[model samples]
Target: MDVNTTTGLSAASALTGVEVVERKGAGHPDTLADGVAEAISRAYSRYCLKEFGANLHHNTDKTSLLGGAADVRFGHGELTAPIQVLVNGRITAALGDHTIPVADIVTTAARDYLARALPLLDTPRWVDVRPRLTQASSPGAVNAPDTAEREASRQRWFAPRSLDDLAERHRMFSNDSSAGVAYWPLGIGEQLAVGIEAHLTGEAFRTEHPYYGTDIKVMVVRHGVRVQLTACVPQIARETPDLDTYIARRAQARNLIAELAGTIAPEHHVTVCVNTRDVDTRPELYLTATGSSIESGDEGVVGRGNRANGLISMFRPWSAEGVSGKNPVYHVGKLYNLAAAEAARRLHEETGLDCAVALVSQSGRDLTDPWQAIVQTSGPNAILASRARRVIADVMEDLGTLREQLLDGKLATA
Candidate 1:
């Protein structure tokens, strides 16, 4: 592998001008898509492992959610049209003579996730779960020579006859060319952004403020030590009886965010704003029936919201690969991102310095190694470079544990 170690300004230190960070709450449409896709992936992996003794090849990262139409009033609201969720991806639906219940798996997972994500919505009444899975291989697979080896490979691509037909069980290989980027030590602005969103969508907050919905978003813009925090959160129609209550709830949310920010970063002066679009003259508000914009025609797609890391930092290096719904066993897009993040965290712990890591994988390479590995430290020190490399090596070697964590839904993806 090609290893490069260098010294440079870390992402936090490089924040010279205005830095922007965003965090989407659990009920956001894009986050919903990501959560559902990941749920399906984990459910399918568990089923395949339990039934067939191996995880099947599948990439369910292409999931999408089309928002439903809703009619809302002061104290009542309902979905006029059902929301449509398309779980689209490739999967090995069959093994030998037994056909895996792909429909049951996808829909069950979708319903289970929706029930948890949007507690106010009746999933069975207002949501439609559609499984659009296929068992097709990549077009390039057909270009191989007409030999016995090619036949064996094709068998393992999607429709494996038995455990012997699964090649990854012996030795896992990277399936795509991709890169994973990660950095350690979340800045104060990042922490506040994430914390505000979590507090607004959390069960404790929701229990007290049932008028506030889960469809929440926090944006933090920092100029030096002063931070401006803006949030867009939906007010539940059932809990909000009138315009006054809605306005009051919005103000309450704003104050809560400001208080939470102070707790998270007392050094930074944070100004909070909520529902900037709301106007005194307008009767309409950022209200929802189910506490989510998805109940009112706001669509969502996987990979369009948060990155593998929860917060989206504008100044930090980011990878386009969506970690959720990816195969945890061999897909470098998922494994490498998780690895790079863990490596950065370990390096920071070991050296007491901010760390950044980038790992690139070539198709067909061993999963334990990457084609290129780059490590950067906040300060200039050659000795720290060696220490960073060792920390990264340890992370790469522990990918097996990472895979298990991923299958168990223990890791945060998106």
Candidate 2:
């Protein structure tokens, strides 16, 4: 393992100047894709682990949703065309002669996830789950001569005959060459960006304002001491009586969010704007039968929304690796991103300094031991550097247990 610990990270200091952060709610199309893909992976993993005692090789991170046509109005709406969800990925469908019901599992998971994500929509009537799973190897894969060592690789590459063929049962290895990055102590803009969306889409807010939809987007932009928050909150057509009621409800929601922002970042001057594209004369507003824009042809794909941390911070560095549907056992893309954030938070708490952690993993490398780890602190301090190393090492050692948390839905991918 190679670890580089440094201090005096001045460029990563105070959250001054202009910063932008955004968050997509659970019902957003992209987030819906992420949730559906992750649900399928978790379901498949649970079935395999219980049936075969090990999670086989699989990566279902390529799920996407195509928007459907709808005739929405102020009080009632109907989906004119069904939304199609393309579930594309690779999975171990058969173990020797025994076949796994991959299609049933994927379809069930997608439908159940969509039902929960969009409560107002009739999932069976308006949504279609299409599974596109395969067990084929990559084009670059080479078939070596039949040998003792090569036999095991061939069995477990996509289909495992038994636990003996699974190398991860003995040692976890990276599945790809990827990087994960994280920073501790979120800025005010970041806090508001994530907080506003959470508050709007939360259960308490939903109960109080049943008209508000789950498909909400919050963008926070901060320059100097002033902050501007723009939020697009969907209103359920059935719950909302008319345009007058919608306008009043929008105002009330906006006021509440502005108050919440004030409480979240008291030092900054925050202004809240809801549904900026709305026009009173045209009577055009963000209204829908389902709280999500997917009802009206808003296409969404995985990896296009928030990161694993749930906030898209434009001012900070991030990785392109999407963590939603990758295998939790050996997929460093998911494990390392969660670990990096955990390590950064722990380092900041222990050292009282803004810290950033970047982990790079090479394909087939040890899961806990990355190819390189760089730790940067806010200021120069030898003591802090040593502590960061210890904290990072401890966090890496616990990477194996993240699978359980992810399975339990403790980590938010979006």
Candidate 3:
């Protein structure tokens, strides 16, 4: 990728060709779905001058104890909000049981996730995602209200019917998918807050029907954008939440794909965030990292000519540059170097396009583990020989027509 004279930014030419990458949760802290969402949404507003921005609110004070086999707890359910985890219970103990406290778990997760995602969000320089904390009582009340719907049980507790009743709330929305999004919001209230924030900021793009009642509609007009960010709640709410590993790996892959795809050369890349209710069985559409052997550095930036595998082989300097001393081939990874590329190519040959694609990409943070591609198309074409091949395919076909119209026209000058 070409760098600007002094800023060292990826030049316009670097945008040519495609780059496929994978980032796991272990490596990137902000890859957490919630964090990524918040970053994009916030960037839509205040980060206009910065690369990224973020805001978090935790109100576990409104804990709820359901009765009769239904134990639902909605304390500051946004415990996982970026950078702010309310410690409802003192942490005199360890991680298990009452040791870590529900609040601590969320706080730790937010801190850890932000560490990695902040870089991708470009929050420091070209990007910014500032995090703000709303002032609250040092230790808010147990805020638990029983919603048993009985006059007897209702007597002792104050339940929250609307987000306002809760001690904390956060909101975000965006028409620009490239913009960052909000990361935490355990219930509808937080989602509403995100939406409200976007609306109030005058940055949340309103929506119209693309098909008909399809929640998957996108609209970006003026200096605004709005997207209904969904959550993999069931998985996220399992007995034990282990999203860090999954998120970082996903980050590595996403970075690789976006970088490589953008390399298609003035091809007008399109990014689609296909959220899944089932992260385990349903792989995200654009979430998979596959294509060519060439790899990217920390923020999806790649070296020159490192990706010479497939269709990208047709493009000049399709991937990110390898470090000065490292073997360029080795830098791209064994998968892209030979075997994986061959396997990826074979699928396209047999199916004319990779119907069930494998997510391919090497992660510098961990060599032994390479992220697999999810079976979904970022675009139409398949034979992703290099960064160029993959991105061109997606931009030409993957981006919905309406979306293309919006970006090409509505946001073209914007």
Candidate 4:
């Protein structure tokens, strides 16, 4: 929550920027990364080629799926290019010789679809993919005990690649401490609400429902918006450079970023959504599924406890190798653009209001580079939940604003 400007309401009208870090490998999530890269390569080689173009001769996903996911972006020139997935025999674990990683395969396939998708978009090229294998378990608790901690001596620490800390800005916009734009609330038309449930308590905030998506609840209370988009972002990783046609399609989607950033504000709306269908795991890193919660640092969600899992590294954001990697930057930019487009569409269609909008989000944690210290974050599962939150918030706020404008213009007729 970084305050960029003050609104009429107060000095707290700050925009948000979101980021998250997820490790790879068995204990972490690199295994999943490997699968995604290889899957993307294979799919690109097969379908994306001979159709989109023919520059794709043979593809090799060199991405070590077991490593983890990198940064995520939403709105504006966040991304500059496409991703490169690398693959090899090492990254493929659960496969019984013929089976490919489910998430990886489909994700890459999805990229292929987006290549020629309806909205027509442009996507950067994902080049130089590399995949590797490891014998780690899954990423679990961040706070390791004695024996487990000792065993972790061999375990490497990775930081958040894409996530950022925005408590300040979020605080300002949330409570109207910063100046904000005016707000004209719309009736909670079964689409939005306000308030929140205590974390893990399942208690709705005084029945204050701000908005709801296919999954997760939302509310705008305490002078700010609270949302929970809780869908499992499939851990199944995927990428493709061979799929130039799909890349072209992705590129087509880039336009929406600007459209949205021009509208929405820092207050008055919140939304959450999720989809936890696919999960990519790495048992080798920390396969055990048992551990306790270990809290650490300020403004950072470090998963510490146990269960042979590597979990999201709380290390510095943007400091991780994979996070700074090129493919992730491309992917983050790609999704941000897609979400922006959706926001614009919603502004016009839902409320019939005319206004520009922008999305501001901040991941729960921060990315610390220069390793050295402890670790950091989430990609697929929790990642999707995070993204959905951002996407829904942007869309809902714009819609709400648009609706208000329409009512003013007597445009409320069916």
Q: Best lDDT goes to which candidate?
A: 1
Query: Model 1: per-residue lDDT, tens digit, 237-271?
Result: 87778998888888888888888898998877889
Clashes of 2: 3
Rank candidates, lDDT, best first.
1, 2, 4, 3
What TM-score do all the candidates reach, one by one?
0.96, 0.95, 0.17, 0.19
lDDT of each: 0.85, 0.84, 0.24, 0.24
What is the lDDT for 8 in model 1?
74
Please give, for residues 228-306, the per-residue lDDT of candidate 2 as tens digits: 9999988988888788999999998899999999898888899889999999789888988889899888988888999
Stronger candidate by TM-score (1 vs 3): 1
Q: Candidate 3 on 7-85: residue-level lDDT in tens?
A: 1111112223222221122112111222322222222212211321111122221111111111112111112111221
Clashing pairs in 1: none
What is residue 53's positional error in candidate 4, in angstroms? Answer: 37
Q: Show model 3 residue runs off by greater than 4 Å.
A: 1-33, 36-101, 119-263, 266-350, 354-414
2 against 4, candidate with superior TM-score:
2
Clash numbers, per candidate: 0, 3, 88, 154
RMSD per candidate (Å) reads: 1.8, 1.9, 24.8, 24.1
CA displacement after TM-score superposition, residue 8 of candidate 3 (Å): 44
| CA deviation > 4 Å runs, candidate 1 | 11-17, 143-152, 382-385
